[model samples]
Target chain A: MKKLINRQPGRVGQWALGLLPFVLLIIAYLIASDARLAANANDKLLPALNSFADAIQRMAFEPSKRSGDYLLWVDTLASLQRLAMGVGISALMALAVGIANGTIPYIRATLSPLVTGLSLVPPMAMLPVLFIIFGLGELAKVMLIIIGITPFLIRDLQQRALEIPREQIIKMQTLGANSWQIITRLVWPQLMPRLIGAVRLSLGPAWLFLIAAEAIAATEGLGYRIFLVRRYLAMDVILPYVVWITLLAFAIDFMLSRYSRWRYPWFHQQGH
Target chain B: MAIIEMKNLWKEYGDQVVLERLNARVEEGEFVTVVGASGCGKTTFLKLLLGTEQPSRGEMLLDGAPLPAEPDESRGIVFQRYSVLSHLTALQNVMLGGELQNSRWLGHCVGKTRKALQKEARAMLDSVGLGQAMDKYPHELSGGMQQRLALAQALIKKPRILLLDEPFGALDPGIRADMHQLVLSLWKSQKLTVFMITHDINEGFYLGTRLWVFDKPRLDPQAPGAYGARITYDLPVGNCEKNTLTRINRSVGNTSRAINDTL
Candidate 1:
């Protein structure tokens, strides 16, 4: 008989194993909710599954009385817009800074220390400062997300560009590539997949900053609604919102990785 | 006139000398194979020719003019690994040299020019026996195939000087033999002035028209960096006797063992 560590799961067995924990968690939640509701029908801490469905239906299907808009879709749209602007701007900035710092000695000498210093400063500590300057609006929320993730992405990409083998750079030189040619031709293409990878890694922190900013200032956002309903301990609404955010993050990460694998097949061929 | 001339060339880093008092003249279309102990300056010598490293003192002349401080279209090089760009396909890798030279700003060519380049690159790849693998990436190719792709890439530029730094050092013996034939045919067809560094003596003799041995003539027990390697032997190949071959083999073997023992 094979030992437990030596044994490998078949495809079907692996799928069953992956779902086991989720299945068990749902069962436990049902039991706990039933017990809580049986003891007190007015319980709100662990709302029943039916109540969760009702809350989602109200937020997603029905229009809000005040704004006449579907609240769930509206909030999702607002949150996604902020996220896109912040991440898109950071990706562009990171590409410029990473390539310049990685390939050019003069730029690296001028900015490497500055980038290192900025990366070390706690981004959350800048929340109040951002609110004060950008004001309590979408710009502040988006700025917070950018501030939180850009430094990390820049450093990651800069290190990636530096990791390009010296032999390749010399080979390019021998082939008559000027400095600009090396950057545009060799470094740029090589760094694309890496940039996507860094962006994927930074998504979690970007979401954290986005939600924190929205909770503090925004009038309409997933995070804003969760905090808005929290005064009444609206776990029914809060739980669903949290789950939706998780699904969105997972979808974005999955798509980015798939896009990288599809668009840069050569980059993925070496298992990197 | 000699295509390349070196007079009392020296290379040093801080207090350590790497190569010293080297003099050589290579004519058009000569294949120079360099062999030495591991720590010797054979690679340093190649770098000087490739224009990656400038001599700390002394001069190197190409076509009776100073060698370019930076590598240019006149030179092409292949290394033991990573000679081919991983991101580009076999055809794209071969076209890159011409593209960079022609398209100054874009680093890639446009419609008509690109089509013409593609045709030429395809022919170059076919010449290197990689016609079926033109669309393949470096990672998709085997070690020998990647080296072939690299050779195609370097030769497409029609460079005057082709520098190869142990380009087949990592291949299996069977694959290496195939590469040797491919390289010799390319050399003759292109009329290229070649410089190759190799650890294997038999390979050096078989592939090179002329052979150079780099060795340190003076070594002090207290100061190893005080002296540097020099071109201790310069011999013509093809007419060598077995007696001379054995002598060179024994000396190279002893030098390698001595260097390895110290490490």
Candidate 2:
């Protein structure tokens, strides 16, 4: 049974993420009770979020004196922007499409050349063509990001899926699995790490690519902010976002890698 | 109901022939092992059975029907290394093929109705003496444990025919015996037909009810499969003595005896 808490090491983070909302709700109720006592009254339902927002603000603004904190905040805020767009929406789309390609041989074979061809081209080179079609908006940026990363996922995930032995698939077949079921049960579970890795690797580059993506936009975003600051020769602000990006990308890639290792420890055993 | 028949089976890779006009029948729920030297075509034969390769020349019939061109969920394979999904824990990997073959919403909705799948997975793990390591990933366990998990995963789908490609080739001596014992037990319990390929003569003799050996004359430039290309032998299963290996050594160890005499 899927217990409230998984009893396995290397899986706590994943289960916790799966169970995050309930944890947050419990914490919220506890805090609500404390505030009710402090105010000496029954708190109204639909309680305000000022406390949470205030906590975030404090964390963001608190350790400005420390350069490291400043750097962390800058990167976090930058990723927050891209995550809202790229990782949030386009990633899901790419996963849906990329995983499809990985699961089915026909799709992979048909789209491989085009996908690989697109992946090899610099993201900058494809910007103008994307702009021409989507017309200078979020659609173009997201599309470019998706196009840029989808191929990497297609290629990576296909090989990873293939790495799943032909016998495993055969075994499943003898047990009586249909194609769709096989994909969900056998293919997706195996490709989870590679897909997650592809998404993580795609993230920072998506942000960097978004810089060129947002060239048409009027304002907002660290990428745009960088271009604006660069104009005024405000290297300090620009430098922070760049450094933030590097660190954020590093951290995300690291977590993604560790998660992959944790999720599928079997792959390492054959060699070791 | 679960009989495997090969009719004039010809498997060739390019011009090389692994099996030339070979015919064999694997009876229902029979435990058959294919044994050969390093260069023999036993691996190729197993691959053909698993539908990993085309007959290049013939077809395989499963239970009176032609074997599907592609692998089916009903057909579970546990290879020496490929059986276990590298990322999932032992229980999860064991449950994976079953869930895929049985459930529709895996990794999305409930991902196999945790209770039912877990129950089955736990049962499978327990049968393999891996109840303690159900939650542990493959790498965290010893080689024997991983092989057990692999076997459990192959058995996950309750397959009528289990195809194993030297699944115990990587295990140490003791574990290899344990694995062989586990297979014999599972085979009897589940009434499954097993087809395994191994280079280990002891393993071939011990676990398998029938031994199919594919031998070829050392590379004849003119003959096909000089590069280990030929379907040379397929023998029926045999009985074992308390120390059958020692007895076989006394009989077949004459070559060594001859060398000793010369020395």
Candidate 3:
């Protein structure tokens, strides 16, 4: 029998291939924007690059007349604060609940079904309930993000914890680890990389929930600003805001991936 | 006095019995190897000895006391895979025994105690010829090297009884030979009461001071679950220097013939 080799592109070539689609997307958008502007000169659907630049300059660099704050910075800070709190709390809760459910038969029986049911309910459907209970405040918005992502995160982490080899637990037992010790030492450390991965996955839904929450009601936020400007068809501001959100999300994902690679080198190696 | 004893030990799951009416005694510091065919419950026997599983019936005693309901530091086990935590480096894995024993929670050992344990773990790794690989993770090590690391992790606890479940089953022949030497030397130096299960008959004979072969005495095609495996042959191999292979073959042959006769 002959050995089969993987004939893939080199690193630089792979990078170029990955970037090609995005480059083409930007070129397509630019051409459409140019054609629309040349036709109508006041097109709101696809504004000129200069209009987008002016919108960014005003929103980010210039202070707002009402609050004396840069709206773009203020919105970014508010959205990020909510996102961090929501994702952070959800991750910690998922870790604790997941470990308990996976390790203890009684806990798994009690909560596994509830968690599955909750994950099945579309989080957006709960937006009205959150608004009614929390009264359209930051609390409501943050809770929306948490409620949206926590169940799925919990299930993902629970399954991961359950997948831990029984031998490892038994080995820890033989090494004198008690139930709690087994969870903390053997289970928790093993679950961390997976936890980071789960958080990264939940980020997309997290942003969606946050924006949905803020779109309906909020005085200050990226979502709130975008929805507020939609009445005037401010595509310039809306487009830049979307790009900024994407950049922020990508930055978070990149950092998390790097952290896992750095902290759990063995886990990363196993994937390869 | 026997260090490990099982009287009329029987283990069953639902209607299927795995080990039946096993009565055996293992003296202290004896290297005992158990061999059997596939699905003959060799692993279940080890689990019972490790106190990871309770016998469905009968008693297991360790050092004149009833076996604990849960596994403790008195017993250390090395599995064929996942014997060591991949997240921890070799030194950290070796230190885990003392850390788990001493630390109240989260397996944290701090201050001078932690430093001393670190030193001890380093020495243990050095003993296993893994001093330089102390900073490497289990995935970075080869199969043989990982097994050595696992050995270090188990021996660090200074367990009274060390249990091995085909620890070298995944290694190549050359590595398996090296592991045999390493295990023997560790056993002798530590004076450990060792219980190992393997599918290799020669390995069972070569390493064990005593050998146990497990099989079903009676095979009923209609009701196979009606009977379970028992210790068919228990022979002393420590002093049978020249005719060890002959003895193993004869004993195994007689046991099978006896089983067939009964059937």
The TM-score of candidate 3 is 0.92
Docking class of predicted structure 2 = acceptable
- For model 1, residues B59-134, the per-residue Cα lDDT tens digits are 9999999899877878889999999899999999999998998998889898999999999999999989999998
| Chain A of candidate 1 compared with the true chain A, TM-score | 0.98
Please identify model 2 stretches exceeding 4 Å from their true place: A1-83, A120-122, A126-150, A213-217, A229-232, A235-272, B73-75, B105-117, B217-263
State the TM-score of the second chain for every model.
0.96, 0.83, 0.90
State the DockQ of every prediction.
0.84, 0.35, 0.77
Model 2 lDDT tens row, A1-272: 77868665457787878799988986987687667656864343323345444534543466646354643356356435654566556556556666667678798778767777867888678878988988866677666666666567667766777667765666556656678777776777666766776777677667667666665552345566566656756443555456556776687778877877776555434452
In model 2 chain B, the worst 10-residue window by lDDT is B251-260
Per-residue C-alpha lDDT of model 2 across residues B135-196, encoded as one tens digit per residue:
88777888888888877877777777888888888888877888888989999999998888
The Cα RMSD across the true interface for model 2 is: 3.3
Candidates, ranked, TM-score: 1, 3, 2
The number of the candidate with the highest DockQ is 1
lDDT values for all models:
0.91, 0.67, 0.89
lDDT of 2 at B244: 46
lDDT of 3 at B104: 67
Candidate 2, position B108, lDDT: 29
Off-target runs (Cα >4 Å) in candidate 3 are A1-7, A10-12, B221-224, B238-263
Q: If both were scored by lDDT, which would come out higher, candidate 1 or candidate 3?
A: 1
Which CAPRI level is candidate 1? high
Error (Å) of candidate 2 at residue A112 is: 1.6
